[model samples]
Target chain A: MTKQVVILGGGTGGTLGANRLRRELPDDVHLTVVDQDDSHVYQPGLLFVPFGLAHPEDIVRSRRRQLHSGIDYRQESIDHVDLETQTVHLADGSTLAYDLLIVATGAVLTPEETPGLDGPGWMEKVFTFYSPEGAAALEGALASFREGRLVVNVVDMPIKCPVAPLEFCFLADWYFRERKVRADIDLVYVTPLDGAFTKPVASQRLAGLLQEKDIELVTEFNTGEVDGEAGRLVGYDEREVPFDLGVVIPLHSGADYVGRSPGLGDDLNFVPVDEHTLQSKAAPNVFAIGDATNVPASKAGSVTHFEGEVLVENVKRFLAGEDLDASYDGHANCFIETGFHKALLIDFNYETEPLPGHFPASVGMPLLKESRMNHLGKLMFQWFYWHALLPGRDIPGIGADMPSAGKQTETAH
Target chain B: MPTRTIAGATVDVNDEGFFTEPEQWNEDIATELAAESGIDELTPDHWKVLEFMRSEYFEKGTGPTVRVLGKTSGVTVKELYQLFPKGPAKMAAKIAGIPKPRGCI
Candidate 1:
C-alpha cells in the first residue's frame, strides 16, 4: 500500500517539503499539501514593501505554481487536528488522513492581544509590517508624514526575526535621510528586553548603531496597551511613550487549530516539540518545523529551511523503523539590513551565541560585523530563497552543522 | 576561502561550509551546546549567559566585561569564572568565531 503523507500550511516549510518529498518518495507514497490560500507572499520582502523598494505584486506568487506536479494541493482553512485518528479536519467539513504528518503552519500576528492597538488609528498613524496588507497601508502613512515621533514597539519576545524591528529603524533613518527630512522625524525603539537584542555582543553593537542613528532605545518596557486614538503606547507599569506614528509588531501565536488539538500546543498555540528532534511531544508520528514549533529560536525563514532538512531526514528514518537522528541544532542565519548599503550577518545555533568572524570560514563573509557585501548578500537572497532554498536542495557548503573556520580560537583569561 | 582583516583580527570566509570538524569535540559535550555546537562540560547556564551577552553586543558592538556578564546573568564574577575560566572575552571568541577579543587582556 502506498503511504499517505499529509502536510499542513503551504508557506516556506510546507511548500519545500511537499516538492522535495514528491520527488523523493516512490509512486507508492502519496503526497498532499493543504493551505488556506494559493497566494504565497515572500514574507521577508514585506520589510522592504513599506519603504517602496518592492511592489506587492513582486512579493506574491501562486503557491500551487511553486509546487511540483505529482503533489496534491488543497485550499481550505484548517479547522482542527484529530491526533487520535491521525487526520486533519478542514473548515469546509471535510477530512483527510495521513500516515505521517508535517505541521508548517507558521505563526500569525495577534494585534488584538493589545488594547487600542487595532483601534481608530490602525493603518492611519499606527501600523505593522508583519502582514502584506499592513505593509501596503504603512507605505502610504510613511510617505505622507513630514515629521514628529515615530515609535516602533515590539510587544513581546519570540517575534519573527527578532532583529527586524531594529533593521526597520536603521532603514527608516536611511529612508528619511534620502528624503532630506530625517532631522524632522524622531525614531524610538521599545522592547520588553533589557537590551536591544537577545545576545549581548550583538545587542551592544546594535545599541551603538541605534544611538549613532539618533534612535532612542526603551528597554524592558512591557506593553500594557496601545492608545491609538491618543497616539501613545502605554507600558504595563503605566509608563507612556507618546508617538505621532506607531509601528507595532503585535504578539505572535501559532495557528488557530493548534489550540483546538488536545495536548498539541502551549498557551500561545505553538506546537510543543522536542527542541532537538522537531518531533511533536504530543504525538510520535507528527513533526513540526518553522514558526509553528515553539522552538527557542528566532522564527525566521532561514531557520525554517534548516529545520526542514533535519525533519525530512528524520521522517524518512521514522518510516524505515530506524532510530530517528535526534540531531537538529537550533541553527539560524540571518542578514540584517542596516541601510545605507550596509548589512550584518549572524550565524548561531541553540547553544552557541552569534560569534564574530567570517562565515563558512575566516576568509569569507565577515560575521557580527557590518559590511556592504552583507547588504548585497541580503538583496540577492530573494532569488536564492525562491530558487534553491524552498526547493529543499542542499545549499552546497551550508550544512546543518555550524562551522568554526573563520573564528579565532583562544581561551579568554 | 578568502581572508579579511576587520578591527585588526583575521577572518576566514568558507563558502563551501568546511570550517570546523565535528569530531574534534568530545562526544559527551555539554547538554545545551552538545545539541548545537558540541562544546562539552559547560556547567553554567551558557545559553542564558551568552544570549544576554549577544543581546548586549548587538546593541553596543563589543562584548560585555566580566563584571557586566556577571551582573546580567545574575551570577557573581567568581561564579562566571567557574563557567568560563578564560572569562567573557575568551568564551565569546570561541562561540562567535572571532579572534580572542582584544582590549580585555
Candidate 2:
C-alpha cells in the first residue's frame, strides 16, 4: 500500500522539509508539495535589496526547481483541510489526501491589519522591506532622500528576521554617511518591545550601538494608526512619532488556509504544536514548522533548519510506530549588521539566551562582538542558502543542538 | 565545478569566482584574479594574507576567518579591507586560490 505525504508551502521550511523527507522516505511513499506560486524567495537576501547591495530579480528562484526529482509540486492555493478525512481542499477545485501532513506555510506580512498602513502614501513616503516590491521601491526612496526625521518602526513582535529593522537602521546610517549626509538624518527606531532586543544582555549591547550611532530609540510604542497623511505614527496610548519617511515592519500571521481549517490554527492562523517535536496538537498525523507554528522560539530561518533535523527524525519515527523524539532545543541564530562593514552573530536556544562566545567552538565567528567575519558570513549565506541549506545537506560539526563549549555563560542582570 | 581562464591558464572557480582548486594557482593567476576582484595589483601586505590563507587551507583543509587573518596574519582587519574593498576573508581566499572558508554561517 502506498502512503501519501503532503507538505504545504514551498518556502524555505517547506523546501527543506520536502527535500530532507524525500531523501528519508522510501520510494513507495508518495511525496507532494503545495505552494501558490513558482517564485521562491531567498528572504534573507531581501534585507540587502533595499540597501542596493543586491537585486530583487537575482534573489528569486523557481520553487519547483528546488524540490527533489521524485517529489510532486503543485502550484495552487490551499482552500482548507478536512482533518477527519485526512484531505486538503484546494482553491482551484482540487483535493489532496495524505497519510501524513506537514504544514510549512510560514508567515505573511499583513499591512492591511494596521489602519492607514495600506492607505494613502503607502509607496510614497511610507514603505516596507518585507515584500520584494516594497523593498525595490524603498531603494529609490532611500537613494534620493538627503535627510530629515527618517523613522523605522516595528508594528509588533515576531516579525521575520527580527534583527532586520535594526540592520536597516545601521545600513541606513552607513548609506547616509557614504553620501556624506549623516548629521542631516535624525534616525529613530520605534518598537513595541521595551528594549532594543528581546534578550537582556543582547538588548543592552544593541541599545548601546543605537546610542553610539546617534539613532534615537523609542520603546513601548503600540501603534494604532499610520496617520500617513499627517506623517505621524499614532499609538494606542495616544503617543505619536512624526516621520518624514517611514519604514514599517508590519504584523505577521500564518497562511489564510490555516484559518479555514478549524481547530488547526490559532487566532493568528499559526498551528499550535509541541514546542519540542513540532507535532500539531490538533492531530497526531500532522506536523508544523517554521513561522507557521505558534512556538515560543523566535521565528527564524536557523530555527527552521535546527527544528527540521529533529522534526524529520521524528517524522521517520512516527511512520515506524515508534515514539517521536522531542529533542529540539529551539536553536536560533542571527547576524546583526552594524554598518561600516561589521556585524555581530548571536546563537541561542529555548533554555539559554544568546551569550558572548566563539560559535561552533574554538575557530568559529565571535558572538555579540562586531566583526567583519560575521558580515562575510552573511554575504556567503546566499550561496549556502541555494546550495547546502535548501538541499537539506547536513554540515559537518554543525548540528541542531546549540554547542556550549565556547559560550560565555556569566549571567548579566 | 566551473573553470575560468586566468592568465592564459584555465583553473576551477566557484560561481562567486572564488578558486575551488588551490594546487593550480600561481603568481600570474593571482594577478589576474586580483584585477577581476577590483584590486589593481597584489601588494606585499596582500601577499602576506594570501600566503597565510593558502597555507592554512592546504594544511588544515580550512581557510582563515577575518579574526584569524587579523590575529595571525599580522594584517589588521581595517587594513585588509583597505587592500581588498570587496571583503577580507572572501577576497583574500579568492586571491589565495582556496575554497570558501567555513564558520561564517
Q: Largest lDDT belongs to which candidate?
A: 2
Question: Mind giving the per-residue lDDT tens digits that candidate 2 earns over A78-195?
Answer: 9999899999999989999999999999999999888899998898999999999999999999999997989999987667788899999999999999999888889999987769
* Cα lDDT over the full model 2: 0.87
Q: How much is the lDDT of residue A128 in candidate 2?
A: 94
What TM-score describes the B chain of model 1?
A: 0.51
The TM-score values for the models, in the order shown, are 0.79, 0.79
True contacts kept of each: 0.00, 0.00
Which pairs, if any, clash in model 2? none
lDDT of 1 at A311: 83
Residue runs of model 1 more than 4 Å from their true location after superposition = A408-413, B1-105
Estimate candidate 2's RMSD in Å.
22.1
Which regions of candidate 2 fall more than 4 Å away from where they truly are?
A411-413, B1-105
Q: Chain A alone, TM-score for each of the models? A: 0.98, 0.99
